[model samples]
Target: MNSNRPGVLILSHCGFSFLEDLKEQLQRRQLRCFVLTSLPLAEHVPARLEQIQVWADRLYTADSHQLKLEDVNNALQTLHKSGEQVTCCISVWEGYRHLMAAANAALGTYDIDAQQALALRNKLNVRNQLADAGLSQARAHALTAPVLQTLQAQSARYFIKPIHGIASYAAFPLREDTTWKALETLRLASVEDTVYASAFNDGLQFMAEDYIAGQEFSFETLLIDGQAHVVAIHEKYEVTETADTVLEDSCTTPPASLDQAQIAAGLQWLEKVLTCMALRWGCYHIEARFTGQHWDLIEINPRVGGSLISHSVEAVTHGHSMLSLWLDLLLASQDDHAPRDALAQQLNAFQWQADGISAQSVATFFRVYFAQPGTLSSVALNELPLAPTVKHILLKAGDVIPAHAREVFLGQLLWAFDRSRQAEELERLAHLSATALDIRYEPGTP
Candidate 1:
């Protein structure tokens, strides 16, 4: 560890609570930490910053980054001019990576700059590069139909997804009709199409490409020395939050569900992507679907998987912590890790419990996050409200909350046991959580 430098900077948007576990973990290792809370409201700003600063060595407000470009630059310039050096600037939050990159560039710190960072966040740009560079991938098109005339020129089942999205946010199966609707509604033909749909379309930018339908699993990796070394193959169990109406009823994952061949194929596929992306000095959470014999590319996230996948990895492996390694790399002048294969040394069975939510009004959900459970006696308040069927609820009353679900993965109940017992255990637990929450969705959206 570089005792000369403090530690890394954890940049967050809206709320900084997400960095809590990482800060605590680092302090356990006897390291200093800094926190900057970005709040949406002005009046509440300094108080929140000070509250964290009491525990943290320093603080920063998000206006320090978002309001003005120089706000971020000046901070960096001031830090450097004051004779300070950063080990690595990190953002487990995907959206804030741009701010991290921007700050690092301003400080001339050791990190990936604003341009190279784009390859990770911008999908269309990545798609074009993959196609032109001949990397292993399922093809992608940003056009709607008459516009896809050029895409139809290339034959494949083609998957469609937004250029900027996270947590499998809005990715889904698409056909010719989807392409036509999107292009026609946006008048895609009238304008020259670009890699990012955000500029030209009112809705979201989507890519239509060959849908690689097969056994699907997640791949977690950290690149070192321009190589995409493979990590654990996560057994992903999820429900489509889009098509489903009964929000809390969806979501289920069994145990040890991936085949050896599927694992091998996913590893092979990411190698090509890492190389093409020239990814080095960071972590990536990639989703790939394997057909009968071929591995097709889904989307790649150059960050850790949310829902505490990193925590689960450490629980199972009992080895290197993903966040620690990520921070080490970000702070490293030398690019190195225990080696991808060695890093994920544990295969012990574990599953993430990212089930479902009530999908009600933000205000309604607010009760679940902030109000405390009233001892089943005092006044009255549904402590675990929000359609109680959601089990193993993490939010306690009086606990401050983040604005969006993306920052926190709300799981009903997660059962961890032997793989043999996991299925039955999860079933019983899921049933219990379902009954407890009893989430009821009335006919229409309120």
Candidate 2:
């Protein structure tokens, strides 16, 4: 019942590894947090529950995957009746962006509309939206049997994936010369993969887009009052996709490899897309490719980048985390009539933090993937750096790993190293991963 403390409603804490860090940040700001999740409270670890009980004002569970708009409004009304106020509604997960928008709109808070949120999430919809804006995008077609036949007849090369996909799930390149048998195999695999893929898409509808060729990069940004501010640009290092999925092997923030002009061009492209999409308030994780001529739109999500990227951002920016900046923007939106210029100034302030770390240090997130399929008996890594670094082992001994599926990774190693030795350190890190790391499999487990 503390009226002075602003309240935030977060949806579905499931499958998010960094919820504790997020909760700690909110706690430090003295904000009252309420989590509405589909997971039962009993399923959580007692230690986790203790921490949640300490910080979260309430954790409500429902039967649905994402709480419906009416459900969220009812909860907000009940909280108001109890002398609590929910100032904002948002979710850090990619799957619930639109659902969060619906709740925010219902609460008369700052948010993107449901329609726009959908466009941001659905890749095909985004391509269409950018095309309408005269923005260049890969030519795409829906992946139907007839459409595949038609494309085959025309002999075109395209990238095929589900309408709503995540982490490169069900994403593959379709060759014009690909046989019908190969297409059928891909379709069957996609249907199976979609069953366990992230939030949206049932693996039914897919699209084939003209493959945009170039080196890929991720631009982390924030849109406030219709202005897009670039936080950091990451150079995504991906291994060749001998398999169906192409996942990021690692990524370096501030992309030391890219020159100033290239960085500006990437940010400019982001602003163009944001302008066309009319994003008013939120964080954006945009992936694109630079063809040495122009930047081609890959996909844009209206949420913070996943996989603990915020930790690396904090390391690079001293202490400013993208989540904190985003939360600050939401808090600023509490003003019923804040001028756009004032909001623009706030954007500038955030940009200063992001730009301040450009010259001091560089951060990298290295993902470890096992090429062989079997039950992992044990894994060992070489001596890790004594400096600030975070390591996560996703799989343990005796866990079965599927063949050629990039979704399941052995672990991730993140570190913030000296800027001057970035190239040397990266090469050393790669050598250590290949030579210093050892993996053993259970006998006859594959």
Give lDDT: candidate 2, residue 327: 73
TM-score, candidate number 1:
0.68
Once model 1 is optimally superposed onto the true structure by TM-score, how far is the C-alpha of residue 87 displaced, in angstroms? 2.3
Model 1 Cα lDDT, one tens digit per residue, 1-446: 22455555566554453577668765875665655445534544667566676766555665432323444555555555655555546677666666677766654454555667655767777767776766644666665555466655555665555576554433555544445554343344323222122222344555666666665556666665565544345544433333201012322222134455545545665677777777664677776666667665566776776554555444333444567656645554333444333433321122121121111111101011111212111112234322332224444333333222122333333333344455554545444443443232223312
Per-residue lDDT of 41 in model 2:
31
TM-score for every candidate vs. truth?
A: 0.68, 0.85
User: Which residue runs does candidate 2 get wrong by more than 4 Å?
Assistant: 1-4, 13-17, 40-55, 64-66, 153-155, 176-198, 336-365, 368-374, 385-388, 400-406, 434-439
What lDDT score is found at residue 186 in candidate 2? 52
Model 2: number of backbone collisions = 0
- Model 1 misplaced regions, further than 4 Å: 1-5, 41-50, 64-69, 81-85, 102-113, 131-137, 148-158, 175-203, 244-255, 335-413, 419-446
Score residue 438 of candidate 2 by CA lDDT: 60
